[model samples]
Target chain A: MADAKVIPFDDDRSRGGGAQRPVRRRPASGGRRKADAAAVRDAALSPLPGPQTGEAGPGPDAGPAAPAEPVRGARSAASGASGDAGGAGDAQQDGAPVTAAGETPVTADGGWDRRIAGGLAFLRRRITGDYEVDEFGYDAELTDHVLMSMLRPMYQKYFRVEVKGIENIPSEGGALVVANHSGTVPLDGLMLQVAVHDNHPADRHLRLLAADLVFMLPVVNELARKAGHTLACAEDAERLLQRGEVVGVMPEGFKGIGKPFSERYKLQRFGRGGFVSTALRAGVPIVPCSIVGAEEIYPMIGNAKTLARLLGFPYFPVTPTFPWLGPLGAVPLPTKWTIQFGEPIPTDGYPPEAAEDPMLMFNLTDQVREQIQHTLYKLLVQRRSVFF
Target chain B: MGKVVLVTGVARQLGGRLVRRIQRDPEVDRVIGVDAEGPGHHLGGAEFVRADIRRPAIARVLAEHAVDTVVHLDVTGTPLGAGGRTAVKETNVIGTMQLLGACQKSPTVKRLVIKSSTSVYGSAPRDPAVFTETTPPKSLPSGGFAKDAVEVEGYVRGFARRRPDVAVCVLRFANILGPCADSPLADFFSLPVMPTVFGYDPRLQFVHEDDVIDVLRIALHEPRRGTLNSGTFNIAGDGVLTLSQCSRRLGRPTLPLLLPAVTWVGSALRTVGFTDFSPEQIRLLTHGRVVSTVQMRETLGFRPKYTTAETFADFARSRGPGLLPPETLAEAVDRVAAALSIGVLDGAPVEDGGPAVTQTTHSSGQPG
Candidate 1:
C-alpha cells in the first residue's frame, strides 16, 4: 500500500502572526501525522479553554502559582507546525478510505490490486473530508451517494413509486414542497425526499421540515439532521427557501402521522398555512405533492392511547399485524405507491405582504388542502389494488 | 488626529498592545492608559494613569484627560492579575459601572467602546440555533464571569439611556484565543487532558486576540452613530469547531464525565492543576453556544481576519506540548524505561498527592 499524502490545509493563517513554516511531506505513510495535524491544527487556533493546569495542584500555596498569565501563553506557544490543518473538516480523513469515496480519482478497469486500491480510495474519501453538509447539518454527499443508494431499490422495485408532474417542480430556485404525510411509520416522507432527488433531472436535494419530536430522539435526530430535516418552523422554512434550496413540509405534523387507518388519505389542517406564508414571503412556488399507497402500508386499526401517553409518543399505533405478530408485524405492507406532484401554486404572484394577511393565508391554505384532497380522491379511484 | 482616546486596564496584554497601536495611529493626538497598577509592558509614548476604576476618582481621571473616546478592555472572565472571584467581579462590574458613570458625566467623552463577552448569551439547552444580537438567553448566567458580563452590559445600557449623545459600541466577543491571551476558556483548552461532559460535543466559537484588538480600534476610531453604534454586536470568527473535534485535533484525548458529576470532574481536574472549570463553562461544554456576526459585518463594518476555526488553529500553533511522549524523541535513553517508569507501571499519588485525575498528556493513540 502507498503512503497517503498530507497537505497543510492553511499554511499561512495557522502560523499565528509568525512567519510561514515549511510544509512537511512525509512519504512513509506516517498516518498519525494526519490525525496529529488535524487534532492539533483545530485546537491550536481554538480559544484555549480554562482549566489552568498551573503546574501546581490544589496545594495551599499552589493557588497563586496558577497566575492567569502562564496559562494563557503556554499552549499557544506549544502549537507551531501542528496548527495548519486544525480547522480543516478532513484533517483526520486519513487511513480509512471512507472520506475519499467522493473524489477517489481511480477507475475500476484494471487488475485486482488496482480494483482494491480504487475501492480503498473511494472508502477513504467517504469516511474522510470528502463530504459536504449544509449549515443545517445535512450531508449532501451522504444522502446522494449512500442514503439514496439504499432507498432507491425500495422506492423503485419494492413500493414501485410512480412519480408524476416532475416537470411541475422548477429545475432550480427556492420552492416549498407541501406533501400529504401518511404510512403508519411515515415512510412517505423519506420516499418523497427520494422522489424529488431521483426523479428531477437536476437532482436537487430536498430539505424536509420535521416536527420537534423527530429531533428530540437520540438516533433519529442525528439521521434526520444528516438527511436535511430541520425543525418544522416558519423560520427554518424561510431560511431554507432564502438559500434557494427545495424545502418539503408536511404541515399535518403528528395529526397526519397518527391519524387512524380509517381516515388514512384525509388531509389534516395545514397548520394555519405557515408553509404558504413562508412561500409567499420568499416569493417562491408551492408544489402540492400527493402520495397514494402510504396509508395502506400500516393500516392503523387501533390506538394504544395510554401506552403512548406513558411512553411520551404522539400516538402508539396498533396496526393489524403489529403488537400481535411481534417484530414481524412491524414490516410494512408492500403496497404499490403512486406519488403525483400537482401544478405548482405560484406564491410569487401575491405581494410579499400577502403572507401577513390571515384571511389570504387561510384562503391559500384551503386552496392547497382542497387541491391535495381532490387529487387524493382522483388517485384512489384510479388505483387497482393495495399490493399490485 | 481627532479622537483623544482613554484606554482602561492598560496593564493587560490586549489593553497594553491596543495602547501602543493607538499611539502609532495618525488619527489620534493623545492616548491615556489607565490601570490599577502600572503596565507590565512598555507602552512606547502613551501616558499612564495609575487609578482603580472601581473608585470614584476614575471620574477625575476621565475629566482631567479630557478623554473624548473611552475603550474599556478591563473586563476579564478569569481573575488573572486580579486576586480572586470577588476582585474579578469588582474589576469587571464595579469598574464598568464607575467608568460608565464617569462617561455619563464627562461632557467630552463622545465614544465608548466596550469589550464584552458572548458569555452574556448564557449557554443553555433551549438556546436558539444562532443567537442574533437581540435574542435573549434561554437561561441567564447564574454565576461566574458570565454573570458579571451580563451585569456589565446592563450598566452600559443604563449609561446609554442616560447619555444619549455618547456613541457606545458594545462588542460581545466570543472566547478570545491567541498565543498571548489568558481567558478561562484558554486554560481549559490548554489542559493536558480535557474532561468533556459525556454524550455532548458542544460547538465552540472564538475571536482571535488580534481581531479583538482590531475591532476595538475600529470602534474607537470610527464609532457608528444612532442605534447601530448603541446596539450590542456579537464579534467572533466565522464557523465553529465541536468539542470532540477540538480535543482530537489538539492531540488531547477527552474523559467523558457523566452530566450529573460534571462539577466533580471540575474539582478533580482542579486538584490536578487544571483549574477554572466553572459551572457556567460546564454548561457551555454540555451545550455549545454560537452567535451570528451579520450585524458585526453590516453595522460595525469589521470583517475578522481569522474565523473561529482559524483563530483556534493559530492559538494551537503556538502552544508547546504539555508532555512529550518518549517515542517522539529519537535521541532519548531507554524508551521502554521512560514509558514504564512514568506510566504503565506503578501509579504514584500523582505529582504531590493530588487526586489521580485522568492525565492524558498525549495519549491520543497513533492518530490512525
Candidate 2:
C-alpha cells in the first residue's frame, strides 16, 4: 500500500498554499456505530492534555498500553463544558485569544477571575515569605497570617492604635516593655505589637515575652514565632534588651490573664520583681503601657485547672460563653483595643549592680506597677466600647 | 457602766496578757476571750468562747455576743514551723477579714484595735529617724510581706470609710519581749547552741510584756482614730551595745565564728526551716532597726513601767536555770568551730573575736 503523507495541523504548505483544510469527518453507521464515530470525532476536536493533568491521566495500575480514547473523551467533556472549543474557533479566525484562563475576553476592571488570581498570588507569597512560620520552634505559619488578616480590618477601622511616648522606646537599644496583661487570652499583647509597628516612628518589631504554654501548642507554636514571641525568661528578656531590641513583657502574665473576673483590673502580682531585675541588669528603660478594652473581651469568669492540666494549658479559662460556645467563643470579641504607652522610666540612673539589691528591685517594681495602675484607670475612662 | 471588749487568741502569751490587762481596766465592763483551743489554761476573768476565726460562722458568733470593741490577737499559726508563714497569714489575714466583717455587722461596735507587727517595715535604711506612723512600710520578700500589714490596714480603712462613726486603730508593734515571751526571741535564746551571728555589732531592741499590755490598755481607752505606733520603742536601756556586750550581759562566753552574710544565712535558714526570722529579719538584725515611741507616748498619754534591764531580769527569773545559761566566751567559740567543722553552719563567714552581742540581756535567741 502506498504510504499516506502526514500533515501538520498548522503547516501552511500542508493546507494547500494557504487554503484551510476541512475539519475531520466521521462515518455515519446510522446506529450505535454512528454514535461511537461521533464520540471519537468529538474527542479528536477537543483541547490537548494540559493544565488539568491529574484528571486526564488513566487510573493508576491500569496497563500502560491502554487506548488514549478514554482520556481524550474526558478532556473533550471538560473542554466542552468550559466552551474552550468555541473560543478556539474564534482564535483560529483571528489570532490566539488575548485572554487568560477563566478570564473574560474583555479587560474589565472588576473581573472576579482576575481578582482571584491576584489574591491567590498574594496568598502564595504570604505562605512562603519570611513572615511564613514553618519550623517547629520558629516560623510564620497559616494561623498567624489568618489571625493577623482577621484582625487587620478591625485594627484599621475601629481600633486606632496610637503609640504615645514612643520615643521612650529606645530606637537602637534594648528596652523592656512592661505592659499590663488583661484579656483571658492576652490579645492585648498582640495589639501591642501592632501598635508598636504601626505607630512607632521607627516601625520597630516588638518581641513579646510569652508564657510557657503559648509555645506549647502545635499550631500556635509556629504562629507565635511569626509574631515574634519568645519564652518570658529573665535571660531572654535581658538578652533582647541588651541587644538593643524592644522587648514586651507582662509582669502580671498568667496571674493577670487568668485572674477571676471580679479582680479584672486589679493586678494580681509582679512575680518577685524578675522584670525589674532584668531591666536593671540590662540597664534598659522600662516602658510602662496600659491596655484598656482587653479585660472586656474575654472576661475570665472562672478557671478549670484540672481540665487545663489535662489539656496541657496553664488554666482553662471559662468566659461567659467559652467551652459552652466551643469554637465560636474562642473568637475574641472585637473590642476596641486602646493601648497607651506611658513615659519610659529611665534605668540610666539605676546602678547596673542594682540587680543584686532586692530592695532596689522591689522599689523599681513598685514604681512600674503604680504607673500601670494609674494609666489603666485613665484608659478605662477613655475607652468607648466593650466590643465593636 | 463600762464597754464590752472581745479579744481572740487570748490563750497565747501576748493574747493572755492582753486579756488580763483589759480585765484590770475599770472602763472595761466585761472581757470576752475567744480561742480555737477553748479557754487558755491561764486566761482569766474574760468569758471564754471557743471558735476558729478562720471560719466565717465565727463572725456571726462575734455579732451575737453584742461586742462593742474588738482587739484582734489571734493569728492562724506562728512563724515557727512548716507552713508557719502560711498559717500565720491565714490566721492573721483571713481571720482578720472575718473579724472585720463581724465588726461591720455589729451596730454596737465602736472601735477595732489591730496589733500589727513592725515586720512589715522589713529592712529599711536605718536613718536614725525612728519609723513614724506616716512612713509607709517597706515591702517584704517573704509570704508575710504586707499581707497582714496591708490587708488588715485595708480592711480597717475600708471599714472606717464605710462607717465613719466607727474608729479603727492599727498598732504597729516592735519586737515584744519579757517574762514568758513565746516569741522567736525566746526560742533563739533557748537554743542549745546559738546560731552564728553574721557580724559582731548588730543592735537589738526589746519591749517588755508589761509595756505591751499598757499600750493595749491605752489603745482600748484612747479616742484616737488613725494608725499609730503603739508599744515599739528603742527599749535597749537608752543605749546600743555590741554583740560581745549582749553575750556578757547574758553570762555567755563570746564565740566568734564567721558566717556568710546574714542575708545569705537567713535566706538559707528560712528555706531549710532552721529559723523563724525571714531574710528581712537578718537584714534588720544585721543592719539594726529602731522606731521612736514619741507619738505612742504623747498620743496615748502612757509611760512604760519596766526598763529593758528589768524586763530581761524578769525573763531570766521566769526561765530560771532551765533556760540555757550563756556559754563561756572561750567555750562558745570552740563549740561554733566544732559546728562549722561538721558543716552544720556551712558558708558561714569567719568572725574576729565572737558573735556580735547587745547589752540587752535578752540573748540572741531564735524567735518562735
Per-residue lDDT over A1-388 for candidate 2, one digit per residue giving the tens place of the 0 to 100 score: 0000101122111222222222111111224433433443334322222212433222221222112211222222222322543333333322311222122234233222322332233332221121222111222222222334344334433343333455567667878899888778877888787666544545466888887666444335334644667667665566567667799999887888887778877876898889988888888889998877678778778899899999877789998889889999887775555566788998878776878999888888999999999987876665434542
Model 1 / residue A339 / CA error / Å: 3.2
DockQ for the candidate 1 complex?
A: 0.02
Q: What does candidate 2's lDDT look like per residue over B121-166, in tens digits?
A: 5543322213455555444435453456666667767777887777
Tens digits of per-residue lDDT for model 1 on A1-388?
0001112222211222111112121111234444544554444442211223421222223233222112111111211112421211123123112212322223112212322332233333332223334456575544543455456557755686666666677879988988999876768999998777755655567889887666555446546766777777776688789889999999898889888988989898878778888899999999998989898988998999999999989889899899899999998888878777888999888876788899999998999899999998988887756765
State the C-alpha lDDT per candidate: 0.68, 0.56
Judge the docking of candidate 2 as incorrect, acceptable, medium or high.
incorrect
How far out, in Å, is residue B115 in model 1?
A: 2.1
The alpha-carbon lDDT assigned to residue B11 of candidate 1 equals: 89
Of the true interface contacts, each candidate retains a share of 0.00, 0.00
Question: Using alpha carbons, what is the TM-score of model 1?
Answer: 0.72
| Model 1, runs deviating above 4 Å | A1-133, A145-162, A183-187, A296-313, A316-336, B36-40, B81-87, B122-128, B136-143, B192-203, B223-230, B243-248, B251-258, B261-275, B279-283, B320-368
Positional deviation of residue B357's Cα in model 2 after best superposition, in angstroms? 20
Per-prediction DockQ scores?
Answer: 0.02, 0.01
